[model samples]
Target: MAQGKLERTGFWPGDARLVISISMQFEAGAQPERGASGPFPPLDPKYPDLPMQTWYDYGVKEGIPRMLDLWDRVGVKVTSHMVGQAVDRHPQLAREIVERGHEAAGHGQTWEPQFSMTPAQERAGYLASIASIERATGTRPIGFNAFWLRGTPNTLGILQELGFVYHIDDISRDEPFTVPVNGKPFMVVPYTLRNNDIVRYDSPALTVDAYLADLKAEFDLLYQEAGRRRRMMSISTHDRISGTPARVRALETFIRYAQSHPGVRFMRKDEIARFALTAPGVPRS
Candidate 1:
């Protein structure tokens, strides 16, 4: 219903029509345990559920290695939204992501909802996460995607104060945009869950082929639209889900399919943030 046009000098580097960003959520130590089978899942952990925790570990060990190899072979830069605790636990994991030329963004200190927290608690948690990332990866995180895309009212202000360049929790737009925070620019790199692999967990479709087809279809339509002007596609991936042996093949398939087309560039989220500053039609505050 909102019809518009984005007047600008150019769309992207090299005048590409579409920008593709692949984000992998690295939440090895941040996922909460299975709670009681009640209306609201209680976080009262009575015991250490080693099995569930090990399932997440698979992402760090087997899944991450596979993903690294595949992405390296395909020559793509990704944004890894890693939990601070996970980075603390496996410092080398974050190091590997950075050494391989990928962006490491802050997911959370622990994978918990931030919408209910006080501003002070949220600030403390984010600061802790930033410090952990710096310690492990040698560079502070510049982008953020809170758990479940939830952020407090002061989240944007906090990010600005902490020197972040962008936020990806907002999925309102298909292309990158900017927001004015106290006269400073806060870039928003929108993320999508419709094309995400998490759909396989609860959606009606039961097969990987179906998932792959849907992803291709979405890309095809977006690519078509981008021809009129520049557009961006944010594909959300999870090391624990897409990194699994069975699902990773489909992911690689999608990557290869997207690469086969012209006018497509795979970028890191940080790159999007920096480019958005100069992008056409973005707010200048």
Candidate 2:
């Protein structure tokens, strides 16, 4: 596929120096009990990992609420990638996300891989996820993020046929770009693993200060690069990972640090995709 690029002179809305897109994952109850990541290996499939299951449950009971409060305090909106089964189990929380003025994007029916599925099964999975988010939030999601950021050859075409405007599985660029999916335009707002909470806090377990420093460093470089052309910084957080008090504090500090700059704006991924599609000098092939 031919990837689109913006002209060197292009700028974001209002000519902002840097646009920060924040993604908050909401996939607590949707994952299978046997494959969860924790300090120890998961138990055999024959036995239920009750402790591990509750670890994810914390995301629903405490993590999400904490993150929501932090965003409210900072006056920044984010995109919450809601899994279908999780939304169905907690429709009120799903509705509350939209009510609070954040975008609800599909993250699949369950936190399972889709790359190995047949094309028909993948299509059905996408459809079911979209329907679940729509039913719970009263707003259909136009953006999708596959579980584990994996996609098959048929992923883009299926998404376009299902009327999705964009997907976040691509990590090839720092800014939004479009590619042809069955001869129609589909947007790819790239996601990042470098700035992901799961990678930093959950696995390697970086210190709060270290995590904050990394975020600021990333923003600093991108802010400088944006002076020449459009640049976007993607920061990812999970309900079960970055929602803890210490990690959330680090995230809030990083946000404030970025805000102190002259021309850094936090935007939702959908907003970024739409702006890129219409922005001058952005290729739309």
Candidate 3:
């Protein structure tokens, strides 16, 4: 067996030092419902997961508005990975995202895992997700961030067939690169959980201060490297996680710090995808 290496590509728009993308996950109704079908069994016999559902609803009711205001203040365009059912439930929210000039990228029909689905099932889900989002936002997404960022072997091919220009299912590279699908190049815009607010829920050690500090350190290194060899950084957030009052401050602080640096450009995922697809100096798959 042999190993494959991902070479760094010093390419980006406007020859900027670094490309920073703020990715927000809006998965309200898309989350697994109580007693809903999934690869795993329900924790309790209930019709709706009241506790979890309300937590997710808070994002739509308060979290999203607060985050949007912060982003507006920061003057950064973010890419939102939304679930179809969530969009359907909150059509106005979906429209608000587009009207705000942010990019809406696909997540899935629901937050369920895709790896367990058969090829046929995955493809069907993918199509339904695309259609639902388009119906809500009036624009078909050009990029996809699979549920929990998990994807099956068929994800990329299906994405390519469905006209997606890029995918963020990979965290292997800090910079954008190409992966061949159907003998055609597909852009892989890397995503990371390193700076995501979901960490607050999963890890007790990752405090708001810790998350802010980590973001600053990550941005500093990337900004420096980007000077010589253009770099890109992805900051993943959630409406439900980063939308809270305290957590939102951390996100706001990081964006402010990143903005203070020179030659740092904020971009949407679709913008990154198009750049990688058409930019010079980017290596082919």
Superposed on all Cα atoms, model 3 deviates from the true structure by an RMSD in Å of 5.2
After superposition on all C-alphas, the RMSD of every candidate to the true structure, in Å, is 4.0, 4.3, 5.2
Q: Candidate 1's residue-wise lDDT over 82-105, tens digit each? A: 899889988998899999999999
TM-score of each: 0.90, 0.94, 0.90
C-alpha local distance difference test of each model:
0.82, 0.87, 0.82
* lDDT string, candidate 3, 1-285, tens digits: 234333343467665778999898888766666754332335576566566667777889999899899989989999999888889889899889888989989888876788888888888888888898888888999889887688889889988888889999888888888998988899998998786667544676668888888889999898767755657898888887788898888888888888888778999999988878877767665
Ranking by lDDT: 2, 1, 3
Candidate 1 C-alpha error for residue 154, in Å? 0.4
Worst lDDT run of 10 residues, candidate 3, spans 1-10
Query: What TM-score does structure 1 among the candidates reach?
Result: 0.90
Between candidates 1 and 2, which one is better according to TM-score? 2
Model 3 quality (TM-score): 0.90
Candidate 2 structure quality by residue, lDDT tens digits, 110-213: 77798898999999899999999999989989899987899899998988888889999988888888988887778989999999988776556578899889
Q: Where does candidate 3 stray beyond 4 Å? A: 1-10, 35-48
